[model samples]
Target: MSINLEGFVRRKTKLKLGGKEWIFNELSLADFARLRAKMAKERKVNLAERRKQLIEEAKGIGDIDPLKLLEHLDKPVTDEEMDAEMESIEGVGYMAYLSLKYAYPEVTEEDALKMLSIDKIEVVVGAMMGGLSGDKKKPKAKAKPV
Candidate 1:
């Protein structure tokens, strides 16, 4: 017997932070493939090495200008936002990385930092993986003839 899957194409959730509301669209297989390709191209290292490098880089920098890491993101950043501080830029980057698309109107750098203070890029990535895993269907077991 085949399991019928309907109405499972897109999933959306709302997130509230710093008196602002944001919508998150569940990632699809295509999104995962894109993310994997982006990461492979940007990091060019294994996961363990990448983690170590990230930690080392963070420790090495006294004042990190997040805009410098804009190349790591899948989306383009405007020149105006490029001058913003690290936290805000990272927040926007993290959100954009996980979601299909997002927009924030008149979002001040300070506001973005405040809104995304508790969110970690790693967590968003893990959530994306989990969402993808949940979408997969388990293999059906074969029936034994009597």
Candidate 2:
């Protein structure tokens, strides 16, 4: 004879199982269904939604093709929007940006114009490390200046 275990579950109460009497917390039927639906919706959007929002906001300031944005999708990004799609890498510096620009000639001021569209602000974070924070690591001292 086949039995449906779900029928045995108490709506919102705890369930004790087996000879050892192991107990597990169970949510109310409504709450369980609601939580499952919410999780599914969240999983559907999450990162992709943030990327789209960031691209939309960036485009608002000027004209840009979403496809061009796709070229740099897998690349590092600047957090210049409400969605804050990209994160600030802790140890990156100005030299790193210059090196990156030097390495990838395609990442020009024009690309910056497309991404952030801020000419005076110059290169984006990936291009020039966004002009490093004022805080700097202390320089090592010379041994015995005497």
Task: Count backbone overlaps in model 2.
Answer: 0
Error of 1 at 23 (Å): 0.6
Worst 10 residues of 1 by lDDT: 78-87
Candidate 2 weakest ten by summed lDDT: 11-20
Model 2 lDDT tens row, 33-137: 443444345545565876787688768967777667756544423324211322322112222222334334555434323333223122233223323422235
In terms of TM-score, the best-performing candidate is 1
Query: For model 1, how does the per-residue alpha-carbon lDDT over 1-146 read when each residue is reduced to its tens digit?
Result: 96786755556545554575665566566664554455445544454565556556866895764445434542444434333421355534544444625334454445444445444444433334445433346799999999
Clashing pairs in 1: none
Q: How many angstroms is residue 48 displaced in model 1 relative to the true structure, after the best TM-score fit?
A: 20
Where does candidate 2 stray beyond 4 Å? 1-46, 75-146
Model 2 residue 103 CA deviation in Å: 42
Error of 1 at 21 (Å): 1.0
